[model samples]
Target: MSETRSDSTPESGRTVNRRQVLARSGAVGLGIAFSGALSELFAGTASALGRSGYGPLVPDPNGLLDLPAGFRYQVLSREGDRLRSGEGTVPSNHDGMSAFAGKGGSVHLVRNHENRVTARFAVPTVEGITYDPQGKGGCTALTLDHRGTVVSERVAIAGTAVNCAGGPTPWGTWLTCEETEDRAGTNGYTKDHGFIFEVDPVDPHRTGAVPLTAMGRFQHEAIAIDPQQGIVYETEDAFEKPFGLFYRFLPNRPRGGVGSLRAGGRLQAMRVPGVPDLSSVQETGASFDGIEWVDVPDPLATRTPVRLQDFGPRGITHAQKLEGCYWGGTCVYFVSSFAHSTEGSAADHFGQIWRYDPAAHRLTLVIVFGPDTEVQLPGESPDNICLAPGGGLMVCEDGNGAQHVFGVSRRGEVYAMARNRQNIGTPEAPEWGEFAGVTFAPDGRTMYVNCYTPGTTFAVTGPFHG
Candidate 1:
């Protein structure tokens, strides 16, 4: 995956590539590694696709996975194929996605499968393995083109449960996130359990399951909506036993400026206000950084679920596996695939990129990955994040599957554009999985990545820097 080395910077040392032994280590934007075909010719001119930029990487383009030179990615759909809504395909793990842009230009993907009714999937018209033991996980609604193909598809939310990672709602639609309430023991979960549900990705109503329970339930992950600033960001895929919190919904219907938090919102959790609300949090290796902002007073419920530290502890640190969240520029970024230890108690190994400078309410960390030698990586975390309009930052790496969907460079340098590890090509030729929800196309120039274990969806366009 490493190639083209002109060397203007990035010599922290260590280099190997294909054999996998690279790591100049550093991350955030604009440098280059994994050989990146000579810095992908200075990272421009692949096409004007989605304009992008960012900086921080002294040189940490996380070595190997290729796709920096003149960027390009296509593959609009996959997962047993057969879309247009014949209602047969789609059924896998694929998590958190939300692309919107349909007036005619076409594109509305809401997708999120995370199926767990017993796995199986592959239902192209019910030939085999459509197995609906109870069906459970859901979310779907494609409508691609821009090269990612697939013209129509639906199913916005099925059996329900476990659906993981979601965000995108200023009134457009999409809030998926169902991460779980207690399904670990095997219980259907028809009661509010782990919530947040709203979809309309240009057509999705298979009975239209709507459960914004005011946006609260617990165990949910990924979801960040501000719609100009209406506020919604929530995340927490509880690894196990812990009240697990991180929320902020506040929309009781007030986009008077850019609102629409579902019209009836107010959900809130994660009480950094004096800290100490505990039940769980701090273990995935634990490390903890700094970023504090707490006030949900009780968006729906959670003045106490588990741990706010018993009810007295605030000063930052607490994101671990927080999974993706985005709002680039002014800042709102959020990711913690791992990190927690500041009395939170044990867990660490890398991943920590925080932000929330809501003008300067504070809360910052910016970049903080771990491996080093050039950027050496065995992989264990760093999930969902997006901001590549020409700004840098598109990581997915939920560890394993071969993991690949990194692009950190607001100066932290980390390449590996797309690599879902599938050595094949069908459904018209596609191969960009495991890259988890990374959108763009408001003008970002096409780029719709997905592939959460089986629910694939791609549509990347050249770097086209010019």
Candidate 2:
């Protein structure tokens, strides 16, 4: 399930697991476009000692979320709550989510539920459109007013598998991705799973579930889109047996508007020359230039994994637990959740952030998470990241121990923003759930997030540092 990489370069022209090390081998030379741009953007550490945020969080007596002095949160939705039309109880294990504009000063929150066949709650069957009748995972839509009050709530799409983390398209649609490759007729699943489905945020019930099969079927974690070029960047959250690849899909017909993904697209995996099978857990601030994309032979790989598809002479690089990707400020910010010394050609680290500049064709290390034993709380496994309105990035943690919604500054400074204080369950057995679905409202006043365990969505408002 895991592989290690040596510091010394492999013999010239030698191939290992489709990775070929060439004669010219060294750290890619840094260029001004990438080096200077990042240096200027991240001039200094903004969150050193948690100074950029509202400050230390006060313990919540209600056993909910703990935030800073001026910050306050409102519980918008919770598990087992009544649905809009009484379809069923609200699903649990909420994951990634997005907030869109609604009529009459309201915001539509499109959220995902990461439940399985054994889940206590199941999204209602819609007959023909349901991917798997036995699958219990799906997404929900909640409408909240400007003050974070719920206006309406309903199940958007249902019967999918592991509706994990996904991104919102520029054209007003939520792309919910399935993180499992579980085949149909196996384990009670009646249909093939592991595909991205587009949900119309306006009216999910009427639009019907449309899975974008051309995007490739893999252990999809998250997706990011470049609005300018109409290209979609994807991350595969595969671990153990088969590794994941960083991919980009070029749509044959560019986005005319929402739901244009049905037209199909060509998939390609990324490869950085010289550093074949690049293990991204390298030295902090290291940069690799001129990264190339290799075409994937079969986009819909049922028997063989798309990442394992060989491209003859030039092979693609494999990354461990690739998750949480976003497109912002002309670059793609992605996360490698966790990795050990045994995987790829990098040192052991809990988490890492990579910045890919499409125009420059370069990938640079942005943040290097320290060991878990380290004292820094925010330096944990950062997942489900999004661009902050007030500069820098907002990261959700899924690491070991206490989970939190931390902030990563432009200069890679980490700081604690919010913590989970939900102590529900038996006295002997308690829950220490991780935070997910971190996003901001279109108006930029309210920040919405999800607690993955019992499924509680919160709308936090305060004097943000935008």
Candidate 3:
């Protein structure tokens, strides 16, 4: 039996299946703001060895991708370049990325290239390509040193569907995810896209771009694995009228590792457990920025992708867009691209950030874009996020048109880190939006960013203050 809010009780931990994604996808174009799509189903890319945003400091009382000072940046990869592995070069637009610990340390990163359209490129022997006609919009795993240099690179997971935002594993691996399940039938390309894939940092050979179906299939954004409990948390990326659902998977093995997640266990969706109404959400188009959560069923041996309505009523809360999800200290913090249902129009489209504390088992609103905080930073669409090893939260702005990187201090004081665009405060030219793929050096000193379009990597270092 499926789970819903009506019969949900602390005693009954039913089964449901889903995942959460932090970095947003399908929402950027040259200089166009794809935000409306974020509320619906954003389709979103980077560059650098040919980098785009370079040179000196730009002032911004408005604060756009600001840095501490005395720090410089460089381009590591270009939109069309040959990889060290000598495989297929970077596809169209590049998205999300992860950094491993250590300076001069070899870091493994998985980037999203939203090449929805097919292109002319050389193919590798061992790799695969899905929707070859749609081009190859998947994740690429590459390695770099501490000082910001590409050591080695390869297609982490190829031949899948729309490859979107993904994160790194605590155990030294990358979790690459597919953003949609568009091709379901034979004509739908390969049956491979739409699952989480684990990529090797030092090695990309033989691991074939495989999808972990045990993680369920639908529209996936980003997923975070809880090292302590070996639980995988995921968010469904949907513009399906009402909104998408948030999920958590309890692997068969507790206190396990990433490989253990493949073992499978109980998959559950969220609901307000005791309050059915708390679970009720109307056709919000694409949202739930602050609607309270209701408890749903747990993943059972005989379960499948279940809609959220069973968990509660119909108008209690607004379904939200779940982007980035990182395991911070004692809680899981995620961001939403918009506030309410944007399946309707632009007016209801804004953004919000939230924190889910497993300890107290509560979801609280941390920051709301466009409401006060965002005003300080216009066009700020909070997407893929990382916890600063120092003491703050690093937020990558995935905007419709221009994107910026922001450093929100522990005290909620937000500062600009790096901008994908050329000019900062003044009207810029290079158009920066989709500022994502952020991670700190193992020492928490330097930061690396990814430019999906043009496809490039950047490094930021300095005596920082946030």
Error of 1 at 368 (Å): 12
- Per-residue alpha-carbon lDDT of candidate 3 for residues 68-158, written as tens digits (9 for 90 to 100): 3576565666657887777756565666777665334666666766544353342233434232433256666667775567787777555
Reference-based TM-score, model 2: 0.86
Q: Each model's C-alpha lDDT?
A: 0.55, 0.74, 0.54
Alpha carbon deviation, residue 87, candidate 3 (Å): 0.8
lDDT (C-alpha) at residue 388 in model 2: 68
Off by over 4 Å in 3: 1-68, 102-104, 117-125, 128-135, 186-188, 273-305, 308-318, 340-349, 371-379, 422-430
Better of 1 and 2 by lDDT: 2
- Looking at model 1, residue 126 earns an lDDT score of 27
The candidate 1 region of ten consecutive residues with least summed lDDT is 1-10
lDDT by residue for model 1 (303-422), tens: 343223232233222444677887654556667665545435344446665555444344434454544432334243678877666555567776533456666543334655665556
Backbone clashes per model, in order? 88, 1, 69
- TM-score of predicted structure 1: 0.31
How do all models score by TM-score? 0.31, 0.86, 0.74
List residue ranges in candidate 1 displaced over 4 A: 1-67, 72-107, 111-164, 167-175, 178-194, 198-202, 205-209, 212-216, 222-303, 306-319, 324-336, 352-381, 385-436, 439-446, 449-459, 462-466
Top-TM-score candidate index: 2
Deviation of model 3 at 408, angstroms: 0.8
